[model samples]
Target: MQAQKFDLVSPEFKRNPFPVFSEMRSCGSIVQAKLPLIGRVWMATTYDAAVDMLRDHERFPQQAVRNGKKNVAGIKWWMPKALKVLTNNMLLQDEPDHRRLRGLVEQAFMQHSIEEFRPRIETIVDQFLDELELKFKQSGSVDLIEHFARPFPLAIICELMGLPDEDRPMFSRWAQGITNSGSIFSFLSMIPKLWKMNGYFTQQFKKCRVNPVPGLLSSLVSAEQDGHQLSEDELLAMAFLLLFAGHETTVHSLSGSVWTLLQHADQLEALQANWSNIDLAIEELLRFLTPVQMTKPRIAAMDMEFHGQPIQQGDYIIALLAAANCDPEKFDRPEVLNLLRDPNPHLAFGSGIHVCLGLKLARAEMAIALEKLFSRFPKLHLAVPEKELQWKKMLGLRSLLKLPVKLA
Candidate 1:
C-alpha cells in the first residue's frame, strides 16, 4: 500500500483530523505519514491493527530515541527546572525501569481499592453538580469544563495522592499550565509551573513519610518497608504521572463525552431514560469520543509488516485510537453515536501490558459522574451551538476548550 501523507500538525488537520483519518483509512489500514514538530511516522487507523501494535510491545517499544543533545539544549535555555523533575515518570520510561515504576504504583489503583473510593467519588460528584445547579439557576450558563469537568477529576486525584485539600486549586492551575495545548516553547514555559507543583508534592511526600496518611503516596512510601520501594526520584515521578494521567485524561473524557452527547440528543435521551444501560453508554462514549486520541509514540524494535505495509525498525508509529474506534470495518455506522454498541473493543484506554492501569477507575468515575449529572439536570442542554464550541488544536489530545451548558 502506498503511504498516505498526513501532516499531524497542519492547522486544518489539527482542528479536525477525522477527515484525514478517513482519507488514510481509505488508502489502507496502516499508512506512513510525516508529522510536523516531529518528523516521519506511521499512523494506524484500523481497530485490529491499532490493537495489534499496542499489544505487541515487544515489536513496537514505547521508548522513543530522545534527541538528547537537542533536548538538553532546549531544556537548558527554554524549559523550566520543575518540569524536568516531573517529566521523568513512567510514561516516558521503558523496560525494567517502567516495569518497576508501574508495579509500585499498581497497588494503589487495584480494583478493590478503586471500588473502596466510590462512595467518596459519589459524594464529590454530588457536591459539584449541586453547586453547578445553583450556579446555573443564578446565571443560566456554566462552563462545564471549569465548573465540573476539570474540578471533579482534580479533586479526586488530589485526594488519591494524599495532597492537602488546601493546595488543590494551586495544583489545578499548575496542571493546566503544563498541559495546555500549544507550541513546544509555550509548553516548555510550564516547567517552572510544574516545578512548583513538584515542590508541593515533595513536601506532601515528606509529610507522608513522617505521619503516613492512607493514600497512594503513603502506600508507595510504605512499599519500601516491603523491600520493593522506589527511590525518591522514582516515587516523585510516579506521583506526578498518576496526577497528570489520572486527571487530565478524565477531564478531556468528561468534556468530550458531553460534547458528543449534545451532538446526538437521541443517544443522550436514551441513556437518561434507561440508566441501567449507563455502563454500555460509558463504553460507547469512551470509544466514540476517544479523549486520549493518540498513544505515546512507539518505535519499531524490528522491521515488521503491519497490515501488508512495511514498517522499518527505529521508525515511530502512533496508534490513532480515535480513528480506529471509528473505523467502519470495526464499528458499524462508525460516525453515528450509538449507546447500545456491544462487542465494542475500542482501544480508547489502549491495549496490552501497557494498557491504562486506571481503566476501571476512569470508567467508574465517568459513569458515576454522568449518572448524577443527567439525573440532577434532566433538562440539561448546550448553551451554545456546536459550531461556537472551540477545540484545542496541536495538543496530543482532542478536547473542548469550553462546553457551555444550562441546567434546566
Candidate 2:
C-alpha cells in the first residue's frame, strides 16, 4: 500500500516534522506530496539528491513566480504597486542578473573585508557579555535570546549598513515585523513595517549618494563596473535582502547553538577544554541545530526524475535540509553531538550559487561570540530545566523562544 501524503501545515507535522521526514526518507530519498498552503511540492531528504537539486540551476530554476510572492495573502496590496520594484531582487532573479548582483555585493564579503570587521565584532560581543554580566548580578538570571542572541546580530548588521547606533532598536523591530514566520497574516502585517524600513533606507541611500561612506549600502550605491550599474529597484531589493537575511538567520543559529550546547554539557565541556576546536564545534552545532529547517521552494525548470520519481516541469520542490543533515548515510551517529567531527558537509547555509552570501560573516560572529561567551561564563548553565525550555512551534525556522542562562 502507498504511504499517506505529507502536509507541511498540518498541526501534527508543524509540531514535529522529523517523524514525517523520517517516514518519507525511509520510503525513498525523494517523496512527492501536497502541502497545506502550497499546492504541490517535492520533498528531497537524502544528501545526494539535495545537493544535486541545489547545484543544478538549469533543471531547478530559482526565478519561479513564487519567489516574489511573500506567501502573505495581502502582501500584494500592501507592497508597492509596481511589481518590478519588489521582484528585481537577487533572491528572485535568474543568472546574469543574479551573477551581476552577487558580484557587486561580493566585495563587501571578501576575506580581507571580513577580517577588518573582526575587531568591531569582538567589541560588540564584549558589550553584550558585559550587559549579561550586569543582568546576572542584578536578577541572578537572564534570557539569553533577548539580551544576547537577538541584539548581537542586529547591532552588527546595522553597523555594517552604516545605520546610526540610535537606529538599532528600530531595525530590530522592522526585522521582526518583516520576517515573522507564523501565519500568513503575520507576514502580511509586515508590509507597513517594511514600508517604514524602506523609507528609512531611502533617506540613508540619499545621504550616501551625497556623502558616501565605505559601507555595504554605500558600496552598492556606488558600484559600477564596465558601465554596468545596479538599477534603483535592485539596490532597494538588495538592501531588504541583506538586512532581513543577514541578521535573522544568524540570530536563530546563535540561539539554537547555545540551547544545544546547554543541553549537551559534555560536548560543551569538550569544546571548553580546547578552544581551538570551536570551529569544528560550530560546524557540528550548525549541522545539529539546522536553524533554517525548510529549503526555499525551487521550481523544476524541465521534466526530470528526482531519485527515479518523475517530477514535471514547473513543480515546486522543498528540500528538507534539517532531515538531510541528520541522515545517517551522510554522517555517523547523526544525532550524536561530536564537536570534533570532521568532514561535516551540512547544508545549514545551503548549497548552490544562491547559497548564503553572509555565511562568512555569520561564522565569524558565531566563533567570536562563542569564544567570548564560554570564556567569560564558563560556569554558565541553563536556569530552567531542559524540558521546560520553550521552542517556537509552527514556524519554518527552528529556534528557541527563550533561553534563560545564569552567569557565574
| RMSD of candidates 1 onward, in order | 2.9, 3.0
Question: Could you tell me how far off, in angstroms, the CA of residue 140 lies in candidate 1 after the best superposition?
Answer: 2.1
User: Which stretches in model 2 have alpha-carbon errors above 4 Å?
Assistant: 1-18, 65-88
List TM-scores for all candidates, in order.
0.91, 0.92
**What would the per-residue lDDT of candidate 2 be over residues 1-408, giving only the tens digit for each residue?**
233476544445533456766777887887776554455677788888888888887777676654443432222444455433653578756687788889888865552387889999999999999998898899989999889999999999888877688988888887776555466667667667766766777788899899987578888888875688777777888888888788889988998888778778887888888899988888998888788887777777777677888887777787778888888888998868888899999998888888888888999999999989989999988998877776655445776778899887
Worst lDDT run of 10 residues, candidate 2, spans 66-75
Steric overlap count per candidate: 1, 0
Output the worst ten-in-a-row residue range by lDDT, candidate 1: 67-76
In model 1, which regions exceed 4 Å deviation? 1-17, 65-85, 224-226
Error of 1 at 213 (Å): 1.0
lDDT comparing candidate 1 with the true structure: 0.79
